[model samples]
Target: MGLLMFYEYLDKVEQLLEQKKDIELYNYLENMHAADIAEVLENLEVEDQTQVFGLLSDEKATDVLEQINSEDFSSLIKALTYEKKVTLLDLMSQDDIVDKLIELPESRQKEIIAFLDYEDAEDVKQLLVYEEDTAGGIMTTDFVSIKKDYSIYYAIETLRAIAPDAETIYYVYVTDDLDRLVGVISLRQLIISPPNRAVDTVMNENLITVNVNDDQEEVAKIVTKYGLLAVPVVDDSNVMLGIITVDDILDVIEEEATEDIFRFAGTNEDEIYENDDTLFERVRNSVTSRLPWLIITIFGGLLSATVLTSFQSTISANATLALFMPLLAGMGGNVGTQSSTITVRNIATHAIEGVGIFKTLIHEISVGIFVGIVCSLLVAVAAYFMHAEYHIAIIVGIAMWANMTTASAIGTIVPLVFKKIGVDPAVASAPFITTTIDLTGLTIYFSLATFMMANLPK
Candidate 1:
């Protein structure tokens, strides 16, 4: 529904609640989609949110919690009593329970775990052991796993028996006696096969799965590459751990994409965009995000200044070389940024497939040469127009070509090397590209000037 309509509904519900017409308010919101109800609750004051939460049926309340983000849910987590929190949490899937608990402090996590039933506590604790970025962390253990010896008829019966608690029934995993994942059968396969056929006969042995310790990004790629509704996660021993659903992959994609963008833009994501952050808080965050790069670039500038100092004698002789410093550094910086941007994206999405890294590098070289030739011609023309020195113009032209080629190489290689070393490519790619290009481009310009003018620096 439109925000206007939702607001209108909220107004009517507020009136109902204020009149102590509990049944009327429940009736009004009970049938609404859980997302809409969550939106209404999110917009309400904490006291009103609690009142509405209290009125919701247990199932509806769980649905509402599932729809809300971790940050927004923190308010309710703080407001509810430990006992009330335990009840609501017990009703949630283990994945949701763990996610909510993570938003709290260690003390709160301990207390919440203490409040859980023995089995639930154990399950939640096991999930908490995995880092949040791993497939095991995002996966839910609430999936169907059946023995392969069972008949198709028996499999159908068993599926019906456990369907209520299973997160998704589209694919039923088959495991051996030791609980090792062996195969999977879709609901359609089970239904279409002869009832008396063995489960193993119908199940597809060729399966796609990710290890429990694999990064969530890998899991997201697996889902996207295979077009799966859910992918089974397993241990190194092939024991089924859980399943990551497409819905969770959708969330991962958004989070990772937003994170990369924030990194590339040199800012914190929530601090910059979140309205709830106070002005002071955003300023603090923004300063930290940008100040580090500014500091690094300042040092890079000093290095460039040092290089220019080495060329003092060359600049003193002609005075024309000083004018073209900006030409070399400016073009190199721009081209390097472009190259790094493309490489970082390819790395993030693992998009370099049939083309291969070698082919991609070759293609980048071809592009760099094309760009260099065109830009060098312009720089040569500009140098002649400004200095009217043919020799200086040729030197400037060669230097532009060389520096741009160097920029392309640095831009393409820095991010790839960072990825190899387990550093975030996005974190270093842009600044590194710009800094290195400027510092190196100056050396190129000065060296060319000194050699061309036959006036080497002392």
Candidate 2:
């Protein structure tokens, strides 16, 4: 639903809740999609959220359960009866069931596993063995595979029998006698092929597959690069394990992007997005994530202060030089931040690596030189007007140019260095880069002013 429509429904739901009109509320929700219902539940009070979830039929309840966020899922699960819990778990996809189970404590996860039927319980246990950010973790084991030696007609028959339980039937995998993935046959291929031909005759052997242990971000990249609806996951021996659908890749993309954004801000996502956290708890997490960076910034600021102290004589000779310090420093910091943001994004997209990193550094430095020229001219003109001294204008202008050019180099190189050291490029971050620029830019400005102090009016 559009945001306005969602709010309209929320208002109506609130009114119904206030009036204690349960039947109307149930009927109203019946028309909404599962995702929309989940959104509404997130907005409502916990008691009402549980109550509304209970109103859903078992099928709709299962669908809504899959759509709900981790925190809300936990809250609603606690309020549900054991039978209802099992019913919903059985109806949910195996991957989604594992996701919800992951949010629980080990003991709680074990308890929930025991509630599942034998096959699903085993599936959850197997999925839990893989890291949550890996291809195996997000993949569904419920995919159809046919023997390569089977006739095209037999393959079609096999697919029909398992199609109801399979997560996707857009492409059917063909396996060897040893059950190794050998080729893939699309639905279109099966439809046009001769019925008597063997599955391998028409199947495409060229395949793109990910190792079960591969990172989810890499898996997402593969899915996007190949325009695949789903990609197969394989063990080290090329044994087909499962398939990761495009929907799961979308979630991975969102999760990774959110993590990078938080890291770029020099904070942790858990600090801000912890569901159902108390205000005090949230603030504590925020402080824990943010304090180290703030401390580093404080030290960096002190270093800038030391630069000023060293240049005290120059500033005392003509107080006007001090007036342009902030402007010079601020512009350098801004340019540095822009360069760092672009570099971090390139790293995230895997667009910059090896030789590309050098190319990017050169490109950013070239950009900085041009940007510095334009900014220097504007500030130089302004400085002359403010102080009525040509030397002051030249000092600020040259400092601006030098600082910004160096800032761009620092911004580009810092993130690349972090990446080379096996750290996240985003950890190079804005505040850290900006502070570094401030220290360097101020040093350049003050030192230049000191050189030209003899030219100024005594």
Candidate 3:
């Protein structure tokens, strides 16, 4: 439905709930896709959400539950009866089931695990053993695989039997008799080729796969770089374990973006709105991430103040130099942030690759020089108009030019430095770049002013 129609439907659903029209409400909600239904639930009161969820078919309930945010899912799971919990766990994919289980306390997770079927329970247990941000954590074992010695006919029969449970059938993995992943064959190739052809005869032997221990972000990079539909996850022994599908990679991208954005803003990565954390709890999370940066910026501001104080005599004589101090510093910071954001995004997207660090820095410096000259000229004119001192205008202009060039160079370099040191570049760049610009900009402004006052025409 169009957004307006969906809104209208929500309004009607609200009215039906108000009248306790359970049967009508259930039927209406049942017709919507799980994601759409989850959206509707998100808009409803918590009590109403529980009621509406209770009315959904077991299959639909599991789907809708997975579509919602984990915090909301936690609340929904808490509201469910023990029997319903068991049913949902049984119905969910192993990867998703493990995710939900991990969200619960150990006691609760154990209880839920106890209720699962033996195979499902074992799968969830194995999945939960992987770190949350690794390939093993994100992949699902529910993919079709065939032995290299198998004939195409045997593979087709196996796929036909397991198609309902398989997460993907587009590419079937070809493993050796030892269960080592050796190759892959597309379903399209399988259908066209003769049934008697050995799996090894048709399979592409050079397969792209991720180690189970690879970081989820790295997995996302591989998927994006290779334009893969699905990538296999294998153990150290080359045993095929699971596949991370394109849809899962999309989730990883979104999650990484959200995390990077939060880190840039100096906030904790997992502060979702649906979390029932108190105001203080949220503040604590934010403060823990932000305080150290603020402390460093505080020291930086003090250093800037000291630099300005050291040039008090020059400022006292010119008086107008102080006005441009803030402007120069602010502009430098803005330019630096721009460079940092662009460079960070380029790194994330793999647009700029394998270039020498010094070369990249030099390129950014050259760009900065071009941009700085243009901006410095504009600021010089503005400074001249704002004051009568020709020397002050020249001082401000030179400071702006120098500061911007330095800022841009630092901005580009800091992220690369962080990456080289194995720190997340996005999380470390913004505060450091801004502070460096503030300190350098102020020192450049005042020192230039002192020199100009002593040498220039009066």
Candidate 4:
């Protein structure tokens, strides 16, 4: 719904709550999607959130629980009795249950576990053993697999019986007698083929599978590469573990992208998700994430100051030189940041490898030179008109060109180097590039001015 509609809904909810019209509120929420309901709950008071949640049917409540934020989920779960909590959790997929349980305390986790059936408890325990960022952690155990010997008719029957619980039936996996993944058959293939055919005859033996320990990001890449609806997860022995659906891959992509963005901004996922209630707590969280990078920039600034100090005589002789310093430094920083952001994205997508790295560097350098020439000409013209000093104009133009070209090189190389050393390239991007460019740009600007003023005609 539109923002205005949601606001109108919120006002209606508040009014209904104020009048103690529980049935009316329940009726109002009946037609809403779980996601929209979750959104509404987010805007409500904690007590009202619990009250609204209580009015939902068990099925809707379970779906809503999966959709709400962790804080609201925590609050609502706490309000439920143990039996009710287990009932709701039982309706959730294994991976989703594990995801929700992770936000609770250890004791609460244990309590919730205690209430689950033995099978469900075991599955949750097994899933929890994998790191949250791994394929095993994100894959849902609810996948349909049939033995290779089963007739196509029987396989369809099996799917009919189990499809309700399966994450996706679009691609049903084929396994050996020992339950090792051997082949896969899509729903389209299943329906079009002769029903009496053996599954092995129709199934494609070639499979794209991820190991249980593979990073979620790597899993996303494979899914996108193949345009798969779901990919099977396997153990090192090729035993079928679970399947990660396209929906989960989408979540991983969003999460990794968000994490990279936060890193580039000198914060992190924790600070982005932090729900501090007071201004002081918010300020403290902000400082904790941002202060370190600003400190690094401060030290970088000191190095820039040293360069300026060394060029004091040059600045005094042609005081006009200082006018264009900001332009040079700013342009260098902008170019460097652009190069670094693209390089980091390429690294994340595994697009730039050995030969590609050289190609990318060359490409960026060419672009930098092109951009530098255009920007330098404009700055040089501006300098000539403002100061009417040909020496200063030439100095500024040359400095701008050199600084921009060098900035591109630094931007490209720093991320590559960081990746080589096992650092996240995104985290090393903007701040590091900006600081390095600032120091280098000033040195270039001053050195060019110093040389040209001493040797060139005034």
Collision count for each candidate, in order: 0, 0, 0, 0
- Give the per-residue lDDT digits (tens) of candidate 1, residues 1-458: 89798988789877887898989899888988888888888777778887887888878887888887665566665677787777777777888877777767888788667867898798888998998989989988889988999999999999989888788999999999999999999999999999999999989999999999999988998899899999999999999999989989998999888888888766647555444668888888888888887887789788878888888887898787777887788888888888888888998888765557667677776788889999999989988888558888888899999988888888888988898899999987877788789888888887877786775222
Angstrom error of the Cα, residue 374, model 4: value is: 1.8
Query: TM-score ranking from best to worst?
Result: 4, 2, 3, 1
Name the best candidate (by TM-score).
4
Query: Which residue runs of candidate 1 sit more than 4 Å off their true CA positions?
Result: 1-44, 52-60, 77-91, 111-117, 265-276, 353-355, 382-392, 455-458
Residues 257-321, model 2: lDDT tens digits: 98888878888886865446789898898999988888888888998899889988888877988
lDDT of 4 by residue, 187-276 (tens): 999999899999999999989999999999999999999999999999989999999999889999999999999999888776753443
Alpha carbon lDDT of each predicted model: 0.84, 0.88, 0.84, 0.88
Q: Candidate 2 — what's its lDDT? A: 0.88
Per-residue lDDT, model 1, residue 327, is 72
TM-score to true structure, per model: 0.85, 0.94, 0.93, 0.94
lDDT of 3 by residue, 375-420 (tens): 9999889878986578778888888899989998988988988887
Residue 73 error, candidate 2, Å: 2.4
Candidate 2 residue runs with Cα over 4 Å from true position: 17-23, 78-83, 273-275, 454-458
| lDDT score of residue 147 within candidate 1 | 98
TM-score of 2: 0.94
